[model samples]
Each structure stands twice: as C-alpha cells, then as structure tokens.
Target: MNLYRKVVLSLVIALPLSSLVSAQDAVKQLADKLQVMDTLLANFQQTIKDSQGAVLQQASGVLKVKRPRRFYWRTETPYEHLVVTDGKILWLHDLDLEQVSKQPFSADMDKAPALLLSGEIAEISKQYQVQALTSQQFVLSPRTDDGVFKQLTLEFRGASISGMILRDSLDQTTIIEFSSVRMNQPLADEIFQFTPPKGVDVINNEP
Candidate 1:
C-alpha cells in the first residue's frame, strides 16, 4: 500500500514569497485553496521509479475527492485496484484478487498525502514546510522524518492541480500528472463507498 500512496499528492498553494513568507502565511494560503475545492475529479497518470532512474511501475487512474474526508481512487490498468474512503472507513480493493481490506481512517494514514485533501489543513500545516518554487509550483517538505515521503512537489494551473512529485525516504520517486481536471463539481457520495461483490473476500477491521 505504500507504493499506492507514495503517488498521492502533497499539495498546497503557490504564491510569491520573494519577501520570505512566513509559515503562517503559507498555511493560510493552502487553507484557502482547499476551502475552494469543495470537490475535485480528474484523470491521473502515475509513475513510480527507483533511485537508479529505472521505471518500476506506471498506471492511469480516475480520482474523485470531496471535502471533509471522502475520496475515490481507482487504478485502471497494469494492476486494477482501488483505495477509497467514506470519511471514516477506508477500503482497499484488489480487483485482480477479488479482495477488500477495510479499516478506520486512523491517525497513521493522516501522515500520508491524502491528508492534504481529507484531513485538517491546520494540522497538516504543522507537519509540512511549504515553499513556492514558482507562481504555479510549490514544494512541501515533511517537518519530521517520520512522514511517509521525504519531499513533495505540486504544480497547479491556476488553482487546479496539474501534477505532483513525491520522493520517499528511500529516494524512490513517484510522479503523478493530472488531466481532464474538474474542480468544485458535484460527486455522488455513494461512489466513495466499497461494496463487496459475490465471491470477493472482505477483511473488515472497522467498527
């Protein structure tokens, strides 16, 4: 699952910081951006590579996210799977294996990039240092070594997220590029849930 989430974006806002903007200002900027994105849907291409610059895996997927903790992510090829959450219960489904794993969206998962979309922005600001690389790009570095990834870079096309780069502690890198971007769009809540089909195994650990 680390590989799956390693590709998740660590996003914030990109603004002029020529005057050495303080952390508080950066956090506020990111909060405003997140607030505006009440919902987001997009097509994404994810690539995972090793430190040697060799490609390890690549896949395309659709991602839908609703504010205050609801998201649906599905990988369409090379290995079909989904990672979804209905705000409380998190689900990981492997279509190839016909299995689903369920658990609470716990504090641990908050350490992942998904927090940028679903968790509290104030809390997130506590964990990452945000820096604007350009007017359309920003980098987020985890304040602690314990974060799942070492560094994250996000690119935006005028408030709509366009790309992400996540580098883990091991130096492995994952790049994600977004297309067909839609923001503040209506997304039905039911899609964020996982329903087990006949013959699929379910491992439920959530209450």
Candidate 2:
C-alpha cells in the first residue's frame, strides 16, 4: 500500500522518534533540526510496491511544513485525501467516504510512525536513535517506546529528505520516495486548517 493508504489504515485503529549518537544527545540534535523554520515546503513522487515486488500504488504531492508543529499534505491520482495538523488538532479527510475525522494532534501523534514522516526532524531524532545506513540513508529506532514502530528509515540527499520507510510491529513496511523538494518557501496558514464538507459524517472522539 502507499503512504496515504497507510495513513487511512491508522484511522481504523483509532491510532495510534529516535536517534543514534547517545539516545539522549541524539534526541536533542533531532529536536534542534526540527526547530529550524528554514524549510516550508517539500514535494515528491512516491512508488509503493508490496513485499512481493508487485506494484501497488504511485503518488505525487507536496508537503508543507512549519515549525512548532503544522503541515499540509496533498496527493494526486488514484484517489484523494487531505491530512493537516495545526499543532493542536489533526484533521483527516477522506474524499471517497466524504467524512472527516478529528483527533487531538497528540492523540497518537507520539505513537504513530506516520507522524514522523511529516514531523519535525528534531522531535523525531530526539525520540529515536539515528544511525547512518549507507551514504544517503539513515535508520531511526525508538528508544523508549518499542510498541509503535519498530524502525524507520529515511533517505536524504543534502538537506532534502528523498525517501521514507516505516516498519511497524505487524511487519508491514510502507515506503515513500520524494523528489522535487522546494524548501524555505512560504505556505499559507489556511492550508493547515481544513473544513469538512457539510452533512458529512463527523466522528468526534471527545468524551
């Protein structure tokens, strides 16, 4: 499945960091990187093939990231969905289902690997250990929480993240490759705020 599909799969479970160096020092370095507000936008194309090497999905999109937590994700082809977080709340919109689900940005934010895909590098590296895996790739494994994602591999060329691979407890891996990254740009605040369609089902987890 593709990254987007994996995201939706997370919803079904009501869902649900790292480092190398010294686990504590690594987390600090990662948190530092995430604090950098230099990059505001990233674009890439992803190919997701099953473990059997069968083509499963292909997608392209841009990711807008802002510091202190905020991002907007948009995808193209096959189907469409929008995922946004405003540091406090996470809004997931399913186009086909015409439904939107809201969760505290912190609900599973710390537990889900998907957040790492779009999360601040500093925050991520802080929670996990960082290991140099080849020339352009790195692997991050959780230091405190082992029940979430077993491992996360990230590929980079310079400061741009070229790809992401997530390994969960179920042994399912979701990989995303990125290209055409444009960093240090300006993205509007409205993009991170989504309004679900009227009359659509709204599932509020608030008690």
Candidate 3:
C-alpha cells in the first residue's frame, strides 16, 4: 500500500456496529475515550487481506501521536518506511528506495481519524455516526461516500486501545492490532519532526 493511503487508512479506524447503545451515545462515549489519549505510543501490527480472507500484506510498526495533530509512524523489520507530520509539513521516507517525499499538511489531512484520538472531538460526531457494539467497542460509518474508508471499528481493552479495523471502498480490509500501548505520557515534540538524510532523493510535493 502507498504509505499515504495506509496512513489515511490507519486514521479512519472506527468498524462493525452491533448497536447496544444509541448512535449519539456511541459518539459521545468514543469522543470521551479518545479525548483522554493526548499523547499515545504503541506498537502495531497491520494486516491486509482480500475479500476472500486471503492475507495480502503484513507489517509491524511503532505509532506515536500527540495532540493538535502530530504523528510519527515507523515500519521496522521487513523494511523501513516512515510517515511523519507535525500539523505542518508531512514526510514519507522509504529506506529501500532511498527516497523521501514531503508535502504541506492541508485541511484534508487534518481530518484523518488519527486526530480523533489526539484532538478534534467535534469532527467525530460531524463526520460519522457511531454505534456501540459493547461498552468498549464502537463502529463508525461516514456520513458521506467521499471517504476512502467504508466503515471503521475501534476496540478498546481496558483503558487502552487494543485494535482497529478499516475496510475501504475496494473491499480490502486492514486490521491494526496495538500492543504495549502507552497513553498520555510525556513525549518530546521533536519526535514528530524529520529531516531528509544527506544522500537520498528528496521529492518536494509541497506547492
């Protein structure tokens, strides 16, 4: 997957609703839960599968987020790929290609569901209708068809987020399971910033 799409996919991670609670209740509950995660650090495993339940791709990474729209994602093991944004410029670095891409962070990028945990409580209610499958599991469906993701599911284990599943328009499913989740911990701002290395192809997509 293009790291951009994967980043966006990872953001809109709310899914399947069993509706034990009202939509309004779900939205409020989810918002309240996310609001508590001002700074989050976690290890994640991402699995992509086709509609037939055949696995297509698997990757493991570390995810970090801070309130007011800062994020850092790193894939280590199979390859090294990174996506970083500080609510300003966004960077994507691929070690195999020896390339890095940069672009200005726009309003659309701010709408990413990742911000839901870091900030933007109102946007959650505005963008999606949420229903509770259980007290700790919630499903969200976008209000419009423009979003690339069709539906999202978020699962919480105890007070920490444990898993998320996103299904896109193409019927491809991406499952993210988080481990070693640490929330509301002090994190240095520098973690969200990046500088391209001395010897790499730097692509400036910013206008």
Candidate 4:
C-alpha cells in the first residue's frame, strides 16, 4: 500500500464495543483533548500481526502531523520510506525502490485519518461511533461501511496519545506504540515539502 493508504488504514480498524455511559463520556473527553492540540510529533514503534497473533511486520518511525492538512511520516528502521503532504500535494518516497510518487491531494484523501488528527473534533463524532474502554482508552468504529478498517482503538497518556491499535476485516491487527511524544510543537513548513532526489524516478499518480 502507498504511504497515505497505509497510515489511513492503520488509523481506522474494527473492534468489539460495549455500551456504557461512562465509556461514552470518556470518548467525549478524549475528543476534547485532541481539539486543543494543533500539532503532534512523536517516535513510534509499529507491529503488525496475523489473525493467529503471529508477528507479520515491525517498524519504527517518526511521525509529525500539523492541523488543517499536513504531515511528515518517515520509517527509519527496517527500511527508509517517507510520506509527506503539503495540503495540496502528497509525496511518497521509497528509498529502496529509488522511486518517488506524487499525487494531487483530493477530497477522498481528506477523509483519511490524517483529518482525524487535524480536523475538528465534531467531525469525529459524525464519522465514528466511539466507546471508551477506560478513562484513557477508547475505541472508534466507522459509521460508514465503505472504510477498509473495522475499528480503531486509541490510548492516551494524560493529554498525549500513547498508542493505537487497529483491526481490519481480515482479522489482521496493527499495534503502534508512541514515545517521546511532543504536542503543539512548532514544526517547520518545509518538513512537509518533498523534492525527489537526483536519479530517483518520479511517478505522477495523479490523473
């Protein structure tokens, strides 16, 4: 999958939910917390597991997200891959493949989970049915069936997001743990701009 799809899919997955008034309240509180931060930067370790709970893949990376619509995600270990979006264009660079792909940011892309990180909290309620498992842990199930993810779980440490777990229709599970998280930090505008290096083939995926 492309970087955009990967991140978006990872952010939305399916999980079972239990109805409880306290859980719903916790979800609301978590939404309130997300609304206060305009930017998030963190180091993350992600692990993917099969339906049988066998490890499928593991990777570590740095993730930076800016409100409205901008982000820089780089996987540093296992391999080098970068994905950046400057609100108008999306760039994916595959260091091993020596290729870079570009596509115009479209409305469909706006529906991705990047929006959940940057868009208004009210929109979140409109898109997902949230159930809180604990004061700091919440599960979100997409309101629409068009999404590939079945459910997504988010865990927070105080006001900072500490981990995320996603389960897809195929029963594959992806767990991402965060550390060194810094919220509302000033990130340079240039970090979201990508200029493909010399000798790397540039593929225009925009139609």
Q: Considering every candidate listed, which one attains the maximal TM-score?
A: 3
List residue ranges in candidate 3 displaced over 4 A.
Answer: 1-21, 113-115
Ranking by TM-score: 3, 1, 4, 2
Q: Which is the better candidate, 1 or 2, if ranked by lDDT? A: 1
> Model 3, residue 181: what's the lDDT?
98
TM-score of 2: 0.76
lDDT agreement of model 1 with the native: 0.74
Count clashing pairs, candidate 4.
4
Q: Residue 124, candidate 3: how far off, in angstroms?
A: 0.7
Query: The CA-based lDDT of model 3 is what?
Result: 0.78
TM-scores for every candidate against the unseen true structure: 0.85, 0.76, 0.87, 0.85
* Candidate 2 lDDT tens digits, 1-207: 445567444522211123334444544544443445455566756565555666566767667776556767766555677778877778777776687788777634644554564555545644666665454666777667646567777676766667777666665566776667776677777777878788888777653
Score residue 171 of candidate 2 by CA lDDT.
Answer: 59
Worst 10 residues of 1 by lDDT: 8-17
Q: What's the count of clashing pairs in each model shown?
A: 0, 16, 4, 4
Weakest ten-residue segment in model 2 by summed lDDT? 11-20
Show pairs that collide, candidate 1.
none
Whichever of 3 and 4 has more lDDT, that candidate is 3
Total residue pair clashes for candidate 1 = 0
Residue 137 C-alpha lDDT in model 4: 85
